[model samples]
Target: MNDFDALQAVIRRLAAERQAEQRACEAFLNALYHALRTASGPGLPLNNVTFDFTPDPAERLRPPPPGGWHAAWLRLGLCEVLVRVRRDEGAFVGEYGEGGTFHLTGVTEDDLILLARRLLRDVAAAYGGGGLVGRSGMPLN
Candidate 1:
């Protein structure tokens, strides 16, 4: 094969790999969403959560590089948290934090899910003992 042809082949292979990884990440995000909704454990399941794959408003001021930061906000009642995932050196790296203070790096979907559950439990412990209020200010059962 000519040099150009070899380069093209390499590019195609890399593209395919990137596409596969993207699909996996998408699947992971969807699974995480469902898991949070149906998650059963120490705290209440986050059935009323909202998720979006957009940059935080502050971060939007500066555009992210290719395959840079991908973030999802999990808004539960009056509580809000951020879940961010990105490709770093060909591996998946993730962070989840309450109120945008990301402090954990999760390498797998399961790890991220576990962190999310812990956040939910912490919120419940903090505000739900007396009564948890929904976004609309209605009491949560």
Candidate 2:
């Protein structure tokens, strides 16, 4: 084919790949949200945490905030953590309060749970230390 046609084919391929990536990101975020929401048990740092999905999962068609295409907010007491899928890296970006930023890579539900647990630990550390407790009165530090 002509050079113009070749470029058009490349553009089409890139567009399709980007769209697939977006879908994958969305699925990943949704699964993560559910995993974190339902997680519970003694000694779990997330017991006192509040989780919220940006644009809500039902509103996926809506545009996302400038921070990321999709986000999960984890709030504990006064500390707030934001988790989002990085468009460029395709990894989960975890940001807590001011300067605590981390990247978590995972693809399965189990991986997401581990990622959430890790985020909670970091958030607890950022919040202060050793004061987080579950309903069972167990220390989570």
Candidate 3:
């Protein structure tokens, strides 16, 4: 094959690999979003919860690292949570409000769901109570 043909082949292969990685990331995020939403109970202060794809500087698309392209942001209330899924190493790393961080090795979806639940519960307890005041200096509940 000529040089041009060789380059075209390489580009096609890279595109396919990137697409696969994107699909995997989407699947993981979907499962996680469902877990979080289910865990949020009635009267919970958590609102505007959103998840989006975020790429880490240390990550690459092809030959995915131990912690691959599965990085996402989970935003709720006044907090932004980082969720990094490391499928190759069977682990996950999370960083969030107030310097709180957790690294779970040999992790499972259940573990992640539990962590998210706990974090939201804590935030509600701390900020959603009536002890605090809103911008107008009125009681907040």
Candidate 4:
């Protein structure tokens, strides 16, 4: 094949791979959302959770990079938790922190889920009840 043809072939393959990766990431996010909601029970305070798939403008012209970032937020009582995911050298890396005070990094999905569950449980215990009043002055149950 000519050089131009070879480059085109590479682009096609990259596009296909990027599409598949996006789909997989979406599926994983969906599963994680459901799991968090289920674990929350009664009222879902995570309604505002969203996923951003748009690539940065600078990165848009070329094929999608191998590693990128994914993030979501959760509110537990007055505490705000930031959950982040990224592809690091062919591996999935997860991290979570609360108000920038406490952070746990380099965790897997399972570990992150477990930590979230524990955080919820601990917050509930600390509040002496199951519901927590959020920053909006509303109880998140």
Evaluate all candidate structures by whole-model CA lDDT and list the values in order.
0.58, 0.57, 0.59, 0.51
Best by TM-score: 3
Cα misplacement distance, residue 87 of candidate 3 (Å): 3.3
Error of 2 at 5 (Å): 12
Count clashes in each candidate, considering only residues at least 3 apart in sequence or on different chains.
0, 0, 0, 0
TM-score of each: 0.49, 0.49, 0.50, 0.43
* Model 2 lDDT tens row, 105-131: 656767777655655665665557555
Ranking by lDDT: 3, 1, 2, 4
| RMSD values, in order shown | 9.5, 8.9, 9.2, 9.5
Q: Candidate 3, after superposition: displacement of residue 129 in Å?
A: 19
Pairs in clash, predicted candidate 3: none
Model 2 RMSD vs true structure: 8.9
Off by over 4 Å in 2: 1-13, 42-79, 86-106, 129-141
Model 3 spans > 4 angstroms off:
1-11, 41-46, 60-67, 89-112, 118-141
In terms of TM-score, how similar is model 2 to the real structure? 0.49
Minimum summed lDDT over a 10-residue window in model 2 is located at: 58-67
